[model samples]
Target chain A: MSDLRLEEINSIHFDVLKEIANIGAGNATTALSKLLDAKVDMHVPNIEFMEFKDLAEAIGGAENVVVGILLTLDTGIDGMMMFILESDSAEKIVNSLMGRTCGSLDEFSEMDLSALQEIGNIIAGSYLSAISTFTNMTITSSVPYLSIDMAGAILSVPAIEFGKISDKALMIESEFGDKDTIINGYFILIPTLEAFELIFSSLGLM
Target chain B: MGTVIKVGMADLNVCKAPDALTTLGLGSCVGICLWDSVAKIAGMAHVMLPDSTQIRNNDNIAKFADTGIKETLDRVLKLGAQKSRLVAKIAGGAQMFAFGSNNDMLRVGDRNVAASKEMLKKLGIRLVAEDTGLNFGRTIVFYPENGNLVITAVGKPSKTI
Candidate 1:
C-alpha cells in the first residue's frame, strides 16, 4: 500500500467509489428533507485522493471557523465521516428547525446544540446505512461528536491518524441544501487503508 | 519582513530569531514551541499523539510528544541555543468535541496536554506559559526575537505570551 500512488488509481475503481458515495448521500438528502420538511438536494459528489497536508484546503481554510460532526467507524471499515457546515449555515439550520430566526449562535441554547447534533446523526446514519446495504456488510458508527472550530482543527483527528504513514487520503466531498448562499455544507468520508482495499475488493474494482 | 515558516500537522521545524515559525489549527494536538532568549533560536513541533511507544511501526518522530519535543530541543541546541537558557511556551491540545461519556478518545486533548508536560519535566525544560485544554482550536505564531508566542482563534482576541 505504501507504493500505491493516488494518481495511478484505476478510473474504474474511482467511479465505483463515487457511485457508492452518491447513493449513500442520496439517502441522506431524503432523510434531511423529510426531517426539515424542506426540499433538499445534493450536488454530484467530487471524490479524489487528497494529501494530509492539504486537508484544510479541501474544506475551506486552515483558520476558517466551521461546525463539524465527526463519527468514527467501528466495524466493517475502520474510518471516519465528517459533516462540515459553515457557521451561518448551521445557524440557519438551527433557526429553521426551531422556527426562530437567529442572527448568531453565541447564545445558542443546549437544545439548539443538540438539534445540530441530531441532524448530523440522522444524515450520517442514513448515509452509512445505505452504504452498508449496498455492500452487504456491517458498518457500525460511533456517536456523532459535534464541534465548532477551525476547519484544520476539526479535520486534524483523521489527518493525524493517516499522516503517520500515507501522505494521501481518499476524500469524498458532497454538498447539500441551498446552493446559492446560506444553508450549505459538505459531507466527507475517509476510509482507512485496509478498508480502502476492502472497499475495492468488495466492489470487484481491484 | 521576517521569513515565516509554516509547520504542517504532525511535523516539526526550527528557525532563528528575526524569523518566525507557525503551526495552524491545533485540536486535540499540542503545538510545542521552545525558544532561547539569548541565542534567538526557536523550534516548533506539532505533536499528535502523547507517546510513540504505544504504536508499532511509528516512523514519524514528530508525531509524538515525547520524541517530537526531545528532537526539537536537540535541534535548537545544535543551532546555538543553550539548553539551560531554553524555555517553553505551548498552545493547542483542545478537546474540540464535547461528549458526555468518559471515553478515552474524547479526552485526547487532556491526555496530550498531560503527556507534553511530563515530557517537558523529563527533559528538564521549564514551561513558562501555556494556552491549552478548551473546546476551541488555535493557530500559533512563535517569534523568537523576544520569546513571544502569539495565539489566534476564531471569534477570540489574539494573545501574546
Candidate 2:
C-alpha cells in the first residue's frame, strides 16, 4: 500500500471499492430477499468521496426522517457499517415481517423496532461476510444499534467518525429495492484508513 | 424578505438582520448561534467535534466547538456589532444513537455542548437559551432580528426560543 489517503484515492481504488460494495450488497440483497420472501433488486454500487455537508443530501435531504441501523466493525476492519431506509420503507418492511401494517415510524412498537434491528443484523452480517470471504480477512461487527431520526443526524455518526481523520469520507454505497413494494434501502460501508490499507494489501492492489 | 443563509457541517457564516442563519441535521453536532440584537447581526457555526487541539486534522477551525465559536464571534463583531451586546443561543448536540460501548465518539454530543458553553463563557457571551442534549436530531434557524432560535425535529413539536 502506497500511503493511501482519502484525498489520494484514485479511480483504480474506486473500482476496487465498487467491486467490494457490489459483492457485499449482492449478498446482503440475497439475504433480504430470503427474509422478505420477495424479489429484491440492487443497483450498481457507487464509491463516493463526499464532504460531511453532502453526506446527508445523499439520502434525499438532511431533515428527512430515516431509520438507521449502525454496526461497528472490530475484528479485521476498524470501521462502521450502516443500513438506512426511508420511514415509509422501514414501516413497510416491519409490517410485512409482522404480517400486518403499521402507521408511521413514530408509532413503531417495541416488537417493530426489534424486527427492524433483526433485519439490519442479517443484512449487515451477510454484507460483511461477503467482503471477508473476498478479502480473506476476519471481519466482525458489534450488535446493530437502531435509530429513527433525521437522515442528516443519523449520517453524522459516520461523518464524525471519518471527520476525525479526514475532511472527506470514502463511502461504498449500494441501493436495494423490493420489487413488489418498490421499497428502497441504502447500505453504506466506511472503513478506517488503516483498514483500507489492510484491504489493499490483502488483495494485492497495492 | 430576508434570505436564509445555510451553515454546512463543520462550517460557519455570519449574516445581518432580515437574513436568518440555518443548519440542518445536527446529530452529535452543535449549532452555535451568536446574535447582536443592537446591530441585528447573527452568526451560526455547525461544529462537529468538541476540541480542535485534540485532533491532528485541525485545519478547519469551524469543525471544532472551541475554535468555531471564537471564529463566529469574531465575524459577528467585525460586522459592526458590539462584543458586549452579543448574546448566544445554541441547539443540536443530540445523542442520535444508543450504544453500549464506552467510546468517547459516541458521547461527542455532550462534549460538544460542554465545549461550546465553555467557549461562550470565555468570550463573555451569555448563553440565553439552549435546546440540546437529547436523543434526537435538530434543525435550527436563528433570526437575529428578534434573537429567536427556531428548532425543529422529526416527530417533535417545533419551538422558538
Candidate 3:
C-alpha cells in the first residue's frame, strides 16, 4: 500500500480494504438484525474505483429516491459512512421498529423518520466499533443524519470532501437484510486517501 | 430524433437547440446550465468544488466552479453561442445534511453555490433562474429550445424553471 494512490489501487490493496469492510459491515448486520428481530443476511461486499457520476447508479440510479443515513468520521480516519436502503426496505425496517405496519414507503410520519435515524445510528455504531477494535485506531462517527432523496445527492458530500486529494473514490459497497429479502440496503464506506494509507500500514498489509 | 446529452460528474458537454442536457444526483455539487437562446446552444457542467486555485495539479477543468464554468462557456461559444446572449440557469447545490462540526468541508454545498454565482457574474452572464440550497438532491434536465430546466427529486414533485 506504500505509494499507492486510491484512484488506481491494485488488486491486493482492494482485497485488504475488502476484508476490512467484511468485518465492519458484518458487525453492522448483526446489530441491525438484533434490533429488528429479523435474521439479517449479508451479501459479498464489492470494492470499486468509481467517479462521482457512477456512484448514484451503483445503488440504483440518480433518480432512484432512497433513504440514507450519513455519519461523518473524524476521530482518526477522516471520511463519510453511509447506510442506504430502498424505499420499501426503509419502510419495512421502520415498521418493524414501530411494531406496526408502515402502510407504504411514502407515508413516513415524523416519528417514523426519527426511528429510521436511530436505526442508522445503531448499525453505523457497530460498524465503526468493529473497525476501531480491529485496527486499534480511534475512529469516531458523528451523529447520524437521515436523508431520503436521490442517491446521487446523498453521495455528493463525500465526493467533494475527498475530491481535492483524489479524483476517483475508493468505495466499498455491502448489502444486508432479513429472510424476507425485504431489507436490501447498502453500507457504503468511503475513507480518505490518508485514511486508507493508515489502515493498510497499520494492518501491515502495505 | 432529439438528443438528451448526458453530462457526467466533473464533466461538461454542449448541445444545440431542440436538444437537452442533463446531470444526475447533485448533492453538494452544482449543475450549471447555460443557454444561448438565439443560437439554440446549451451547455451543462457538473462541478464538484468551488475553486481550483486552492489545490495544485488541478487538471480537470470541469470539476471546479471557476474552471468548469469557464470551460463550459468556451465550448458553448464555439458551438455558436453568442457571448452577450448567453444566460444561465443553475440547480443542485443543496446541503444534504447538517453537521454540528462546522468543518469547511461539510459546508462545501453552500460554497459551491456561491462560487457558481460569482463565476456567473464574473463571466457577465445573467442568472435568469436558479433552484438551489435545501437539504435535498436534484437531477437537472435542461431544454435549450425554451431555456427550461426540469429539476427532479425523490419524494417531491418535479419543477420546471
Recovered share of real interface contacts in candidate 1: 0.61
lDDT of 2 by residue, B76-98 (tens): 88898899898999998898888
lDDT of 1 by residue, B5-97 (tens): 999887899999789999889888899999999989999999888888976546788989999999999999999999999999889888777
Candidate 3 lDDT at A104 equals 73
lDDT of 1 by residue, A1-206 (tens): 43444456788877777777788778888987888788887788777778766878867778888889988888998878878888888888888888886647677788988999998888788778867876788999988898888988988766666654455666767677866424556677766666777776677666
Clashing pairs in 1: none
DockQ of 2: 0.84
TM-scores of the candidates in the order shown: 0.87, 0.95, 0.93
lDDT of 1 at A147: 86
Question: A47-101, model 3: which lDDT tens digit per residue?
Answer: 7777766777887887788888888897889878888888888888888878886
What lDDT is reached at residue B42 by model 1?
Answer: 97
Q: Which docking class does model 1 fall in?
A: medium
Off by over 4 Å in 2: none
Model 1: residues with Cα > 4 Å off, grouped in runs: A1-12, A100-102, A178-183, A204-206, B100-102
Q: Pull out the clashing pairs in model 2.
A: none
Better of 2 and 3 by DockQ: 2
Model 3 agreement with the true structure over B101-136: per-residue lDDT tens digits: 666666788899999999999999999999998888
Model 2 Cα lDDT, one tens digit per residue, A53-122: 8878888889998999999998998999888888888888888878886567888889999999999899
